[model samples]
Target: MEPIVDTVVIVAICVLGAALARRLGFIAPLVLLVAGLGLSFVPGLPEVHVEPELVLIGILPPLLYVAALQTNLVAFRRALRPILLLAVGLVMFTAFIVGFVVHALLPDVPLAACIAFGAVVAPPDAVSATAIARRIGLPRRVVVILEGESLLNDATALVMVRIAAGALGAAVSFWDIAGQVALKAGVGVLLGLAAAVAAAWLHKRITDPLLDDAVSLLTPFVVVIVAEELHSSSVVAVVVAGLYLGHRIPYLLSATSRLQMDAVWKLITFLLEGVVFLLVGLQLRDLVSHLEADVATTFRVTALVFLTLVAARFLWMYPATYLARLFPRIREREERPPPAVPAVIAWAGMRGVVTLAAALTLPRSANVPGDLFVFVAFAVIVLTLLIHGTTLPMLARGLGVREDTSAEDALAEASVQHAASRAARERLEAAADGAPESVVDRLRALTDSRSNNAWERLGSQAQETPSAAYGRLRREMITAERHVFKIARNEGRISEEVLNRAQRELDLEESQLNRSDD
Candidate 1:
């Protein structure tokens, strides 16, 4: 199939699946996966062979970067111990366990090959983690740990895959592998910090919103490319850069730029995730065709490998949770979670596109078969997404791990806004001048109206306020302007550029008015 046509088809499927998922009350990625799988078997449809580079470099960075952007810095810091245990220690542990099980399943597969495959499948996929968290009511801490682990674990897995491959090919020593891991990790961190700090400095100097947005879009790609060129972990670079930038956003960005940047990145992240999950599903047909083992043998080995990976995560999480609490300071200072949190975390493991991408990179060696390795990795991702992804929400519910609620969100938001409103009023008073008393009063009214919205939402349902009526009228005016501009474009009275500029002004005005309600 032509590349453009194929890309269009995949995107359409993803959007459709995502829409269907929401209507059916399932996670979007799972639906997209199933859609891709079903579409793969269509008659005369060509199989998709996504270049591993496209996903790893092109898609992965921005996804991680945006995810890190939404991360709460304080929560992530508090959960650092468990996050590292899952992200780094558990990744390595799971890889070894997976390697052992795969080797046991297929005795002919070399230990190196087994480990290589394990590394590919080690990390629990971030997409499933985020998507399921939104659909289900995962606690804030659980969400933080899952997201934080995701942002770092891929780098760990990738570096380990590289080391395992080298050990098999060139007889590399254990200490050498350890040194390589440390050096790459350290360099990656330095590179990410430098990149993030430099970007923020430049951002401070740039006055144009368009230029600022362009830099923001390019941030993740540049961070990843530079780190990769320097023989560091691009994934780590993206994550670190994201965290730094997100942490500084309140201080660094103008209100307009923050709003624009938020919308742009959200759109970008959504599209990338959809494309990835859809592509994941589309590879099923190809994987089945290329397996070297008989159908029964392949089924047995893949199931065993997939099951072992899931079991390995559960086995590792509970002990690690307790291990962290063993420190007196940690136990004394922090809120101790119920044991059910670890169980839900364990059950939340669902491998996705990253594993598939890594599997595609496996080279056929003297002893190892690349096709078989790819097949196993592919099976593990699909099987887990099918089994674990489908069941995780229910499992978390059954275990009483639910804490996400509108009430909690509203309470937190109300508290932040309440404090911010006080600060805003003080700043306004400090800057007061010969400006009209009415202007100052209007500003104060807007601040109070905005801050009290969440509380009002949680309280009694009331009649429409005067402010809401004003906002509704303003939106109608903006809608009229949009329609007029669009008509002029259709009638050839205005150029496309002119129409877009007009529409954008109207859109921004509408947004400002709408935001006043909240």
Candidate 2:
């Protein structure tokens, strides 16, 4: 096999794929996957043989780190019960169901191979779900549940896959597997926490903004390598470290460091997502080449497996969510059970790269029936992407599970608060400059009333006595100033680079001012 993949090709694909994905919207990944498939058909595209070890080492760590950093821990905590059910219970249930179905359908295939198939396809890809979910107005709770599940489910699936793979080659006891799983998971978590704590301490010690940002960038790779070196799941470790670091990033890093780190990660994540999906598409050619079975038979088996997986999610989600509500301790303080959450849960089960990668990496021993597994995995991914991903927005619309307008409302309220805070700070400065006491008192009262109004709006509280009639006017003034700055850059009144820097500074100031009310 050609030496894995060239770095130049990888970089080119990601850069081009991202540009295209942005222009094409939801179909970007689909487009990239198709491109990869087409490229694979060419004579000199280089046979991109994927190693399972490479994926666990190269691809998983940074991806998991980015996912964890972006995840809203507060929102995730709110949906903890649902996440647990989906991530742990539901994934295991799906694996067992898929294993049974695969065994019955393909009796020639070993049970261990069947279980391996199930394990590969169990967890939904975080990148794919987040991309699609953002387009539709998924409620914050639903998004959190999906993200948290994706982040943690890989470890569960990997443990089972390892057990299945081992059993296929030799006799394996359940107790041994269980002990290994516990050891791997426990060690991974401990290592991740230790790494995060060390990084945090180092961050605190270093005050230079540039060095702090550079150190933060190094974290994901460190966490992943450390975990993998210790024979643990790097995916779990990266996530744990990411969550720990992200939660404390604001306190540990300077404002400039925080800004730089956020921008760098966003770019990295975008490229990783593009490359992975493109590779998924490219691997289809290799999978197809190994098949001796009839095309129709393969299609039939794929469809059956796809339907089973979809049906299993619906079966699991409704009862699990309902049961979760029965225990007060399990329910989040702000969480109210949504009547139509079942539909949301069912629709959110879109599989992507992890499944494809696992399938492509299957051992090609003659007894393993690796071709069938790869074909089935690819079939499920395509079907899920087209059937579930394409129709999710329509389903959400039908269920009346529209985007929570609350965040928008909160943002508007935040903008108003920001304007008021700016005004308050200006007045305070003037007071410090020896402004009249009476004028300062009047300005202070205006600030207080504006602040109170913003709080009421954010809390969704009923309107009390109206003290400030010009909150809207103040917001518009701030917005106009931003608009003018943009126009100045476009008209070449200021250099584009300078304009971007100023705009970011203004944006940060606005965010800070809004946060003051909280």
The TM-score leader among the candidates is: 1
Candidate 2 residues 415-451, lDDT tens each?
Answer: 8787878877786976566778787777777677667
lDDT value, residue 253 of candidate 1: 84
Clashes of each: 0, 0
Poorly placed runs, candidate 2 (over 4 Å)? 1-10, 42-44, 169-180, 292-297, 328-339, 406-518
- Any idea how many clashes model 2 has? 0
Return the TM-score for each candidate structure.
0.90, 0.78
lDDT at residue 404 of model 1 (Cα atoms)? 46
In angstroms, the error of model 1 at 298 is 1.0
Global fold similarity of model 2 (TM-score): 0.78
Candidate 1 per-residue C-alpha lDDT over 273-316 given as tens digits, one digit per residue, 9 for 90 to 100: 99998888889888777777688877787878877887899899
The CA lDDT of each predicted structure is 0.84, 0.76
